[model samples]
Target: MTPTTEHRPQMSVEEFEELERHAPETVRLEFINGKVQVKAVTDGNHDQIVAWLQRLCMQHRPELWLYAERGMKVEAYRRGRARPDGVLAPFGFAKGHGDWSEAEGVLMTVEVTSHDADTHQRDRVEKPGGYAAAGIPVYLLVDREDRTVTVFSDPEDGRYRLQVNKPFGAVIDLPDPVNITLDTEPLEDLAT
Candidate 1:
């Protein structure tokens, strides 16, 4: 079941930016539908998976830009901002370069599922729609408990049309824009 919403006070983009600027280094903040959310520190499994994936991606050197837990300000229709876990940019590009905004074109994005099912649903359902509307090519979800990875691609009509799910030890293939393969064995090992 997906997460339901509740009534919350809304803030503008400027207010959100102000909060982000004042936020402590350890506290990660994201804006969703004009509401600010503070992200928790990752667990051992989350950290391990992030590090392993980063290392694999670096070795491949697909010219794709990878960011971990970076703040991505994506444009949404009714909701103002939507940020994913990891955002993959086109090759040979760097985010937050001079005169660049977080709300830039993204090739792919990833989200690691949370313990809370509602949180998982938020990433799996809500963010995907926002990303698809933003024209992102691919979205990946890593379910730590389930030891599965889901790849969502082929966006049509402002939503993803194709979905691929693979378990641990499976070789996952990224889109052409990011031609890289990930072996889930290391991730599974880390989960243990």
Candidate 2:
């Protein structure tokens, strides 16, 4: 038998898009698992880090496209959508707007850990499982709490089979989609 849609949203994707369209620019919200969650405000440091990563990714691969804080649908047991700091996909992926992109052909997703405890947990813990379940090849996590960048790759059975981490001052080597060594020396600790 063909596989069926295991997850269904409590609020339809159309409703989520409508809510986002009317919501204020400062307010960040996400339809996670079945409920709408008010996300934490993005700090200056977080913005800076995301900017730098996006720029670097663009420079490294001009053929591909990088989206900043783009929504993507990735879940196996619930209709959970996650908006990552940066999502690396093909050139034509932006054509599909105002809705969550299916997590296929997605190169990798970046998540810069924020200050809020809840947001931090969502990014560091919950999102990985969801992304992996959706067959996302790579999940890059920038943890400001410990000043480390962790790369989770090789998803199998809703979990990453490999994990590698580097401190803020070291060079982080990204495989596949972005086969380049990133200079993490420019990244500053948010605790300051």
Candidate 3:
């Protein structure tokens, strides 16, 4: 379903803060291009990818803290609120605090693609730029149907210059912020 531009004014950091005070449980909102966009519920494939990534991160690197489907307010020259499918933060930053504001240093953020063309495009194209602008060093994308994981790194000029695409079973070296090596076998197994 296409989102309507109606209801409330264009999204701003201040406006989003106000809305957060009154946001309902059923409705999830994200700020995109100064607009509040509703996030759709994740499908099974999305859930699988998230789970696989989280599990792999935890098993390989127990020291790093990994968050799933949590709201992260990334402040760049332009402000935006994003909920990455998964985020890896350095250990001993801030534990037991669900608030992202307290957990400042983030190593990597991941997004799992859905069947929707718009969603896939946004995650693969727009979000990389946004995350890079926010100074997020690493961004991983898991494409379920394609059975591939794309790793984007070395953000420069609001974009990631390095793109590494690996099909199932390839080992991906997690970026500098976190020290860990993960294999894509588990993610590939999710397809079946």
Local accuracy by lDDT, each model = 0.68, 0.79, 0.73
Model 3 lDDT per residue over 1-192, tens place? 977776434866877867865889776666755666666667786787787777777887887766886677663664777777888876655466554442258788888876665676567766788788778888988877688888888878878888989887899776677666778887766764
Q: Tens digit of lDDT per residue, candidate 2, span 75-111?
A: 6753677788888887788675655788877889888
Cα lDDT, model 3, residue 164: 84
Model 1 per-residue lDDT tens digits across residues 49-103: 7667767777786565567765565545434454466777655455345312354
Preferred candidate (TM-score higher): 2 or 3? 2
Q: Candidate 3: which pairs clash?
A: none
- Give candidate 1's whole-model lDDT: 0.68
Clashing pairs in 1: 63-91
Candidate 2, which segments miss by more than 4 Å at Cα? Answer: 1-18, 189-191
lDDT of 1 at 167: 95
Poorest stretch of ten by lDDT in candidate 3: 94-103
Q: Model 2 clash tally?
A: 0
Where in model 1 is the C-alpha error above 4 Å? 1-9, 77-79, 90-92, 95-105, 116-118
Q: Which structure among the candidates has the greatest TM-score?
A: 2
